[model samples]
Target chain A: MSKLASMLSTIMILFPGVAMATPDIIRQQLPQSVPHYWKWGSLFVNLQVNYFKVFFLVALLAIIIIEFLHFVIIGPKKFRESGKKIRVYNLFVRIVHWTAALSFTLLVPTGLIIVFSKFFGGDGFVRAMRSLHFIGAILFAISVVPLFFMWVLHMLPEEGDIRWFMVGGGYLTKKEVETGAGRFNPGQKIWFWIATVFGTLLFLTGFLMYLRKPNFVIPFVKYQIDALRLAAITHNLIAVIVLIMFLVHLYMSLFAVKGSLKSMITGYKDEEELKYMHSSFYEKIKHKLNE
Target chain B: MYKYSRMKFYCDENRCINCHGCEVACQVGNDLPVDIARRKVITFNEGIEGKEYSLSISCMHCTDAPCAQVCPVQCFYIREDGIVLHDKDKCIGCGYCLYACPFGAPQFPKDGAFGTRGVMDKCTMCAGGPAPTFSEKEKRLYGQNRIAEGKVPLCAAMCSTNALIVGDAEHVSQIIRERRMAHGHGVLDETPYGWDIAYPNE
Candidate 1:
């Protein structure tokens, strides 16, 4: 009897419906053929419960520590303000970039709070953070379209991209090195695509998760897919990638390249910076500057 | 002998008639919102001959409750009797519990902008929350503390066919064993539905 009971328990554990059948309605509602525990559900739970907070902390710490070391060792690139400022960004571009920046500023912190909700211990504060996250999503939705359209042309791959990567975009040395980079460096271009493309995916998955019961049906699929579970898994995975890239982008603009933040704020780039950081674009536009 | 008594809920598929009495009883007893369902009656192979069966499902209040494991705020607490309860005030309404729950027990009110989730509400097994027993605050937030009054959960109490039963884990299993034996089944072999997931150690 014990052997039989053990065998039955094993079967039930291995195949959920083998010992005591699951209701058809429950089956239809939460289709088991899709492998909820092994495939997606456990993965989502593990990522959310175990890894997300640590992942965010480690990523942030790694970036901060690495950037600190870089600043101490290699140092920030110092460029002489030649008093000749070129209007690199117009009013429209500045507005759009800041709008996206503000959204990211809101989104990233609130997202971290949500991940580390245990530390906050929930309540009105954490709840407020959740609401703030939604607000950030709305801001991102408004800014992302214009941000993409305005810079996509300049962000595309160019012959200079290879040279920029090979020389590490002159970031390793304090001395200025001519990197054949365009108006936007390869680093900037990569950040652009990740923010726009992966940001879109994040928004979509987040929306599905917000809905909680998307119940989306694929035409050819045999079993009903758990859309919310998939959304959650994809959202967390994409979030990690976006978060790391956002940090790098932040470090690059705010600290690594001195005066980079000022360029965005004042809508002007120093002539010296344009010469060394964007040598290829400087070559093309230098005549216009002289004229 | 067990060190501590574990409370559990069991729904007999053979006896359940799909009347949805438990669902209605729970809602009415708890004064639950229309959007929130603490208990649900699901039927298998409806309109089919010889293959039809029904059962009630809610928070299994698992020994290793997954919702508690996944809750970001650590609001969930399992009672000495193994009743899983959570502090509503501490919930941030993130809805992680919903994803982790195998039985889809967690329900959220659409209270936020764009129909985003409010705080989670689930079956408390009539044990209420961390609030003081029978306090007005407990009643206001978590509905009745029926367990504190030594009453069966409203769902089981009102189960028309006595299909849904709840009590000490040992007693529940004993009843199930007798029922199986009386039905000409010599020995209990198969685990009760959801037991493998909810109480794997049992």
Candidate 2:
């Protein structure tokens, strides 16, 4: 079969509900794509759009409120002495982190507008949103490349992660908790890995979704409709999960954890700040301080 | 008052030969760029005996068209005559309609890899879009607004086998019913898009 033949075959299979002339012959053949799986398709449509949107917004808001209160009640962690600063993050790392942050902030709103602003936005807004999304996607792709490589080694699951996770990464308890945290706690490690893995997946899926026309089906690349549908489903699902994690991440670093946001910005953390929160990391790097 | 007839397209599988006449005529009539086809014919059960069947699939122009429902730009409109039309100027070519549409009616000019492509182009059901009816601008963006000239679509008119039928849903339904009854099949009622979705009220 030709590439087009394969594509059309996939399309025909996806649309078995409409095709298949005789209603008498029961279609025992299962649909390959997620959308064509009987009521499963409609369920996905509702879940992917509505639940994803509601959950994302509600979780973000809830995280904000909780993090705000946590910050107020606990207050920022401060050492009595003017502590020496350790060069934890390099300048390049800070630049990449800010690039990721700025792109994400821009991306989230633009994505929400594109996905959820149907009832209100006109054609002009739609065009604008799409163009903006395309631009954001490029920046995001660039940021992801650097962030993935920069953080992958730092995010390796450590021996102390089990204790860190068991103690809820020192977040649940107000009493001084021995998290045995590295430069990043287990939670941050999880977020870093998820961000890289799922972020890469989103890019791949979004890339496939961007490709729309039938003419795109080259000989080597069998760009079938069913594959497109699958990619779209995965993209939406991954996006929702990633967004929730992102909100949680943003709150923890910026609002919940004191002095951490400054470290990300300045590539330096107070020596006492590191000793208090991340002793394991400080011990590892203390030998380098004398050099 | 809702006076205009509800329009529809019905394909009698029994008569269809999978000949690309309707497809060709539509492309020529529209002067559509090579990448896009406003109409197409698809076949199933190839090489298999008895089960081999084909259907001429294009925009059925549903009353509560999902294309209209899902369009981020709200580019589509259903005329009183039930023709589904879209404003090209408004379409950003995000290709949501292609995802939403069951018939796969929406086609874009650039169908290759990499970045964004051209604006969306799809079946206008012989009726031009939001641009002043029968105007040259409509013709330039969309193709001929032939429905305004009291003529059927070029594809339906050019179908040599008379397999692809286009008209008011009721009349077309009657023709299909009569044909089916003559062939000894029971009278199976057909709903023109919206009834299945909004059945009781519809």
Candidate 3:
């Protein structure tokens, strides 16, 4: 009888589903460490931390170095604003621009530190950077609303943009590229589009990772892990593009073009430069470009 | 040459009295923040007679540690003896480890503006981190290094019922097996949760 009992227990261990079925008392407390979805999500995290970070960081450094050398090689343009100032950017436009710019300025460094802090900092350092990044992400997401609404209509890509692209939008080649685009040039339109699309993506992904749970999974998405993983990968990829475009925009507005910074600051552009730079748009808004 | 024995910890639920002495001892020993509980005794069916059982949980310091694998900073390291240790200096507190750990061993103190995770804190298995052995910095960051002193961990040592056991994996299991034989039959989580994931031995 004892030998039969021992044999029965061994068989019971084999078909645990049939034999040692979950007792109610222990059901809720079984240590569920890793399920399939968690492991799948982990793959995305692996890619994000390893591939995206290394690749984008390299690209960021390369862009800064190349742009700096360009400045050294070809000293920025000396477009004298013809002394006839016209109101190109209204107060609303200026406000949105500064808000986006300031928020971006804070976001970039803090975001990078959050990613790379493990390489350099301790608990205290990471804590500080994480806090800063959270604030910056909120400001960034909020600023995008005004920025998109303000510039979306004006940034529609016109027919001339194709020609502008061929000539490198006057950014690549030293010679002038005649775009004759509307209020926003084709190059500017491209920047605006990239920023709008990828900027929104960054915000979404940033928040998903920030929330740290299942509160914001994509609707109708059966696979929560897939959606979250996609978010993680997409955010990293778009962040690289956003960083590049932001640098280019900053350089052009601040140094590459002489009157560009003044126009944004004062909400006015030199009438002569405006006409020469945005000839077609200049035609549409000339009358509106008040003295 | 054989390195140190594979370090491991086992908590017998049958012997546990739900005293929470392990949790309190760890917090006091580590000087961890109130919000951070390096060790927690999770009690199931608290008031229900005969169904009451508590599990003292913390980092298992797995052989194939997921935290070490997933850490972007590569902060976590596994000693030859299979004790997992992480460098605080290299931890970004991104909470990747928290998500990856099967035991939920990695913990983050809530600190950032959006309740953002602070640096990860977990059981060091009584072994200090990368800091010089027995140094004050290591003591402050990783709690006591009793293993280096040839002593049992405070959690197990302070267990009034001797429910928590910590030492070499082989020796600990042998002891448990002997007890099983002596007692005929009792509840046992035969495979330490996540043991295969940590130390595949494959």
Please, what are the lDDT tens digits per residue for candidate 1 over residues A113-152?
8888889879999988888898899899999999999999
The residue-level lDDT of candidate 1 at B133 comes to 89
Any residue pairs clashing in model 1, and if so which? Answer: A24-B44
Off by over 4 Å in 1: A1-28, A31-36, A215-225, B1-4
TM-score of 2: 0.78
Q: Which candidate number has the best lDDT?
A: 1
Q: Model 1 over residues B43-162: C-alpha lDDT tens digits?
A: 766779998888898889988788889888999998778889999999988888887777778888767544578899999999988988899999978989998899999999998888
lDDT of 3 at B24: 89
Q: Return the candidate ranking by DockQ, descending.
A: 1, 2, 3
Q: What is the C-alpha lDDT profile of model 3 across A170-287, one tens digit per residue?
A: 6665555455666777868878888778888788777655544332225754443344456666776788788888888888888887878988999988766666567677777767
Give the range of the ten consecutive residues with the poorest summed lDDT in model 3 chain A.
A21-30
Task: Write the residue-wise lDDT of candidate 2 on B1-202 in tens digits.
Answer: 2533777787777888989889899888888886567887766666789977666767767666766776656777877877888877767676667655545577776522233655788888778778898788888878888888999989899988888888876788788888889988779655433234321232
lDDT of 3 by residue, B72-115 (tens): 67788888888888888777777667645655567665554456
TM-score of candidate 3 versus the correct structure, residues matched by position: 0.75
The two-chain DockQ for each candidate, comma-separated, is 0.30, 0.21, 0.19
Pick out the ten consecutive residues of candidate 1 chain A with the lowest summed lDDT. Answer: A16-25
Of the two candidates 1 and 3, the one with more favorable TM-score, higher being better, is 1
Candidate 3 local Cα displacement, residue A127, angstroms = 4.5
Task: List candidate 3 segments past 4 Å from native.
Answer: A1-33, A69-80, A118-127, A208-235, A286-291, B1-4, B11-34, B40-57, B69-77, B89-92, B112-115, B128-141, B154-164, B173-191
